[model samples]
Target chain A: MTRRASMAASLVGFGVSVAAIFLLPSVLELFTLINATIYVSMAILALSLALIWGYGGILCFGQAAFFGLGGYTYAVAAINFGDSTWAVVLAMVVPALFAALLGYFMFWGRIGDVYLGVITLTMTLIFFKLFNATAGDAYKIGKAALGGFNGIPSTPPLNLPWDVGSPLAPEDIWYIAASLLVLLYFGSRWLLRTSFGRVVVSIRENERRSELLGYDVRRYKLGIFTIGGAMAGISGILFANCVFVSPTMFSLFYSAQVIIWVTVGGIGTLLGPIIGAIALQMIVAKLGTLEVIDPNVVLGSILLLFVLLVPKGLLPLMQSGFDRLRRPKAPVPVEPAIRPTATPAARRPEPVSAPVGSAPATNTLGGS
Target chain B: MDLAVVVLLQVIAAVASLVLISIGLAVIFGMMRVINLAHGEFIMLGAYAVIYATRWGVNLWVAMLVVAPIVVGLIGVVVERTVIRFLYGRMIDTMLATWGLSLLLIGAATMIFGNVTAGVSAPLGGVTIGEYQTSLYELVIVAIVTAVVLALMAVLRFTQAGLIARATMQNPAMAASLGIDTSKVYAVTFGAGAALSGLAGALISPLSGVVPTMGVAYVAKAFITVISGGAAIITGTLSASTLLGSLNTLATFVATPVIGEVTLLFAAIVLLRILPQGITGKFFRRAL
Candidate 1:
């Protein structure tokens, strides 16, 4: 399939998913409206990381930093503005701005990929520590007290755009979450179809080659990183509406869990992370209720099994199975060659035979 | 004068701990070019080995000095055989895989030894330095670190096994062509690195205690030290540890531990910005 056709197919698939979500309350009576809303929010968070890591080839170990920042910004802004609409705007803007500044220093400085991981992890720890230490009554922004580790309680939920007095019902919130997910999903697909997305993917393939081709690699990287931060911020806003924002939002565990979701879902696809997040989270929630086995053991085992046995993840596995059924003889291998107009899967078959010592196209390791 | 002496001791102790934690990572990451995100877990395993050994009627010294390294080294060998052997050249994949390994180790440890922090009291007591008293164990750590560095230097510089290990790291294909059994060398080198980490963990257990998640705290600092140290393993690790470690200790003395940590991270950022490849990458080009 051509890139345009594949994208169109994805858009249709996304529409179907959105429709299913809208019709879920009646079809699936077991899931509470509030619980479904929370699941949608988690899926959005997973999609944020999937965009940056899977497509941009930038593995951010501290996505939760931007995520928590968004939540805190929304909560604090809501207390001051006495409205959720403005709070949501601040939530996205603040994290995007922060990401832009951080990405400027990091990308322009030309920090290697390994160090990038370390630096981002440090940033998350810093945020976690900073928030955890704000237990005193003095750490107040406007009227909302930063309750340290205990976290801010009873912050206002999303209200109607014009009437601040009337908050959205759980059902309304679910609809909003589902709608936002569909919009963002299609929006990202559209963005990836643009020329700028091609450049970003090219840079991810080979930074030096892209630079030689006159692309400003750092600028493109910074843009994608900021967009990812904004996406994470949006997820945070949905999260704050679902559950109260806490310091745990910035924890390393959440950051690791996001990585797991993206990896399990398959990194390079739009829909993979959403499926991974919702599916794994439901499994985790189920495991939590079963008191016999420790959830960490199960999670750790799953992660190990996936990394070793099925590194390409569930979506790719399913795709490959489907492709085999369609055409049994010619199994296409995914290669990281520069194929600007080809669909992602179609680009996979060509061996990435770049010059020796040149950057591996699929590798994000950075630096020799 | 006494306060000055105590502060100097603290600085030396800080440097010693940094070196001990990072030397293993330098070997595995710097020499092998395999990013072992599970390096911290190896240290954690070492700490647990010492604790378990002592509980099972071994002497504290024996448990720390002998059992911990041996136990963790064997575990490292098993890990290398099963997981790391397949991921030699793929740096990022190795990182992801090892990170998964780390989580597994942490979970397993938690299962075996609940979620509680365990520890042994610092031995040899405190010694008076004019006005203030400091742990004698701190001085012991400094001495031990000095010995470990010297021993590592001697082995790498003078021994045949060291030459083969170095050869394998520099060019595995060439080393294998020379009938050196490059795979064995890689496995041995990784085990040695893990043993060093285990030793460091056992040595520090009295101060920090043993916890399944304790590796998280040490891993970041070790990565910073090793990365800032650069390509040359010994000189890089030593110089980087001294610079970052002293700065951290001095900052702690001046303010709080939190400020000290923040200062260390800021210092690393500034240092990396100035010298992107690291301290040794620029200066100690010939010193290995």
Candidate 2:
């Protein structure tokens, strides 16, 4: 199915973006607005997996490795530099570099699919173990100390640009986070709309076919993996700004939660992960307050119920339901039939990777 | 010289436990291609089963040998029918669902067992080698692990049931056409895997003690061993466990537990880079 949203979807997305960035703060309570920042940051984490798993077809189980690295990088850099700006940039760069390095081993070595999952999963656990062992004065990286289980609590908050004297208020931080999420939602949608995005998605659908068509599938996979890592890093920076950087960031629980958000939010759509992360985090957080039930039991049950009943997830289910009400004259197969019945022989000759203008498979692959 | 003997025992103990914990996960992944994220929890369930059974007047050996696998095997069957049956071939979904199952198991254990409890101790006493001393249980464990691997290989190689399982895994459609029930095979294989994990848990409880969250310590190591083992499940598990378990024990002996873990991960990265499909993927391709 084409991932591109229709004109109406674009319009609705714009409205949602405006509402989230410009309107939601006024309506939400002070407590919830602060919590919403965490949710927004987590939504980015969910989106990172969505890009990798949903579109790139790479189910990276160690996303939190990059994420925790982002937090720790920011905490360490921020402490050392006495400014959050460079730390924020370093947070994104460090994780991307790490992913690139790790991805180099896996992809260049032809480690794809399920094996990739195990390696990445093990990598995250390794980070958790390594970080947790970093106790005492011996583990400090410059001015910042790796506090082992008790993560760096003294992490500097993001200041107004380079003005380290003035830190952003929680309200201001919320503004930046909420707006950054909106900008990123559009950015992700834009990235998918680009030639690069379609090629990545096509590779996900059929790697061998894409390779036969002359695209270096390994490079595309690595590129997407790196981008996902950087996106996760940004989320880490935002997360550390609110909560202190800790080893728990690299824990399996966070790793699972990001995948859960993407699954629940619905894969193949940016908005789905955002919605899923916020809703589930709110549910689990609310449940955490109640002493009666362990939040994990409820979380696990909900995930189980969702996977069994709605494996396609909430977004696609809702879209189909909406499509049913809107289109009485046709079925779901009509959308895919937009592409020509066969590849035009005249257009099949040269420039195998150009993704030339207006050709169904090559150009605007997901054009709605 | 005694230190060398002690280190050798450590490496053997490490490799044996790695095999014990990972064999079931290897079976499930090898046969069905289903990554049971809750494989570690299945181990936990087995340990708990032993503890409960022993508390209910069953002999410790009976609890460990028979009750653990039976209890967990049945649970695995139930899991397959309810959750896993629908998720065949969907690897990522299976991982997430089983991960959720693990969370439920951990939470349930925490609620029921109150997070901590007294566990059964190893039966044997210490054995000394010159200046160094070690647990005699470690030797027994190594012996038992070897027997378990041998029995598993024998079953898969010699039995009619093993042949049917092999055929079904090779081509479920063909097996079904041949009038064999593939789904039943899948269920049985998954149960067997869980049973093995349960047995591993029971075996390990004496060394590590039983806790709700103990599975977290095992599942990653098991996954690494199984995945690094590659297409050949039995031999792969053996080879990967020996290589990895030795590196881990040797590093821990030289440095610390954390360094040992880092060494294992580093070794896995190098192994996968060198042999992406794993050890069995490159060699012993035909052997089950």
Best-matching candidate per TM-score: 2
For model 2, residues A1-368, the per-residue Cα lDDT tens digits are 23354656677877877777777778888788888899889998988888887778787889999999999999999999998888889999999999999888888888876788888988998899999999899999998899999999998899977889999888888989878887777787788878799888878766789999999989998999999999999999999988889999999989989888877777666677888998999998988788677787887877887777876578767766666576666544322212211112211122234332222442233422
What TM-score does each of the candidates earn? 0.92, 0.93
Candidate 1 overall lDDT versus native: 0.81
Model 1: residue A202 alpha-carbon error in angstroms: 1.4
Candidate 1 Cα misplacement greater than 4 A, ranges: A2-8, A26-33, A329-350, A353-368
- Which 10 consecutive residues of model 2 chain A have the lowest summed lDDT? A340-349
* Model 1: per-residue Cα lDDT over A179-215, one tens digit each: 8888887787667767788788777667788999999
- In candidate 1, which residue pairs clash? A333-A348, A334-A348, A335-A348
| Docking quality band of candidate 2, CAPRI definitions | medium
Backbone clash pairs for candidate 2 read none
In the order shown, the candidates' DockQ scores are: 0.37, 0.50
Task: List the TM values for chain B, per candidate.
Answer: 0.98, 0.97
Task: Write candidate 1's Cα lDDT for B1-288 as tens digits.
Answer: 889998999999999999999999898877788778788999999999988899999999999889999999999889999998876766666777787888888978888898899998888989998979999988998898899999999899899998988888778899999999988998998999999999999998999978999998888788888888888899999999999999989988898787787778778877876787889989988888
